[model samples]
Target: MNFHPSHPLQAFWNLAAAPIQAMALEQALEHRLFTLLAQPATAASVAQQLGLNAASTAVWLDLLWSMDLLVRHVPAGKAEPGYAASPLAARFFVDASPENCAQSWQYRARSLARFAMQWCTLLREGFEPDGRTKEGAAASTGSWAQAAREQIGQEQRVVTAPAVLHLMDALPPLPRQGRFLDLGGGPGHVAIALARRLPGWRGTVCDQSETAEVAQDNIRAAGLSDSLEAMGRDLSHEAIGGGCDLIWCSSVLHFLHDPQAALSKMFEALKPGGLLLLAHAELADDPVLAARVMPFYAGVMLRGNHLPQPGEVAGMMARAGFAGIHALGRIDFPMAPVWVHMGRRP
Candidate 1:
């Protein structure tokens, strides 16, 4: 007997999905449990109301039961247990629940499902110049400003922008510090965070003119302008100036139609051995559960930017001719996971 040695390159293995499970779940979500949980109903009553044949309805119920999507409960003075939406579904699946993020995320999920269904055609037809986006779909529903107007938004901590790498705490202090450049910085959240950690560092937050105005106001509000500041630059087409030590590209790439090109430009702006920190939206640790949550953002990326994967990110940095690459911490704050990748110019 003989065994093969490992290949010197990445392996591309085919994934065989159990479509039966997915189909069962989809059917239950759409038909039986969708309205049945409006009030307690037996499987037979649900089937009758939804027009599902007894056999098919039984199969759907069984699948939900096995998956813990529904619980069988015995009503008082009743012999058989009546079926009801499981605890998980009651809180999350019910559309009327105020706790449901479905409205905020429904657009995302629908977009992904449409794309995944046509992925084969997409690969073959290639992408249009604007990008491979679905028509009529908009990115993130609205701009950050629109969100702020609706949700007391001003400039609050959604989360860290350019996440600090572990090396920040481990590496020896540097002899000279350059100006920090934060692209797509909102309300100076990143600059303030960085200033707190590095007193000697001066920073700039560059964004659209309107956003820049907001960010500048936020920087002054924090009294960090003694060290950090803000600027307005359209990074999509403009050449950003230099004299920067570390450039923070947080949550910007997912909105970039050409992330690699932007990364190259970022690399060009850095001095030798200067750092380029990047943060982008990522999937959760549980791949299956995240399948429902993360891919929705793909629509937002498709319509607006390209949310690159970790491997794609590393490859982009490499193509930018950066070195000393590092992986930093992740943000999985019950909403979505954001990946942090960084590198240094040689």
Candidate 2:
């Protein structure tokens, strides 16, 4: 009998070691290591500048190089190779980069790390619903408002705004002058982008009151106060104004207690033949792809929110009486791949 080692456990081992890699990157980010490596420098030089142990710094730099976050190159007349930020790191991790997302990245990393610690307890005894409804609402609003003020804007400017623009370019052109609605638009970055792209169109961003205030401030700052407005309304229960020519909603439905109802509301809000573009991450059929999505949303799921499966949102759209429903493929979002689904109100 030929003996074959069952599937190697390297994948599991890698999973076990994943936290170490994350910590390495976190430490580097905290130390502004990538910014320091914006220009190539020998590890000894890096150590001298950063006040780190030379030998340990060399090993750390090598690890980052292996991770492809840094590149090693030999400078003219130099025996020792120097490490610099890789293109990827330079674009996103370096503080001087226009599209830098290092702070937002760290915020998310810390959030997810905290969430990860709750998994065991959450699994054993499911999350308890907040009984104090008023307090919960206030807390939730404050958290979202804070995110709108800080983290969400960075993500939108760096990742989401460009993705939305690219996705819009692929679709059929809308009217030059029409009413547009951005549901759950935090800080109004997406709304601002769309407003700039369609100067003739008037836009409204709907979010929680505090968040909408943040969006309003952003709209004013962008000089779009004349054409763009933010509406503070609880979308799950309140009315979203009707006669919208286009509605752009992303990563929002899962947070609602009744997504189906929300879809119906969105359908009602649209004018006949209006377009609805919804972008959200659904649990994929492929294990690897699903793995990419699930961890980020696990807390949402544990908190009794619904994370849609593939085709699920489309089916909901169909039931909501949408016509010309179609999947627009996946957009590589900041943390995960989000499927864009389009439907027309007929």
State which candidate has the highest TM-score. 2
Q: Candidate 2's C-alpha lDDT?
A: 0.91
Q: Give me the runs in candidate 1 sitting further than 4 Å from their true place.
A: 1-143, 146-158, 161-176, 283-286, 292-296
lDDT of 1 by residue, 222-248 (tens): 888788877877777987788778887
Each model's Cα RMSD: 9.5, 2.8
lDDT of 2 at 46: 93
lDDT of 2 by residue, 57-141 (tens): 8998888888899999887898999999999999988888889888788889889999989889888988887755888878978
Cα distance off (Å), candidate 1, residue 3: 46
| Residue pairs with clashing backbones, model 1 | none
* Lowest-sum lDDT 10-residue window in model 2: 1-10
For each candidate, what is the lDDT?
0.65, 0.91
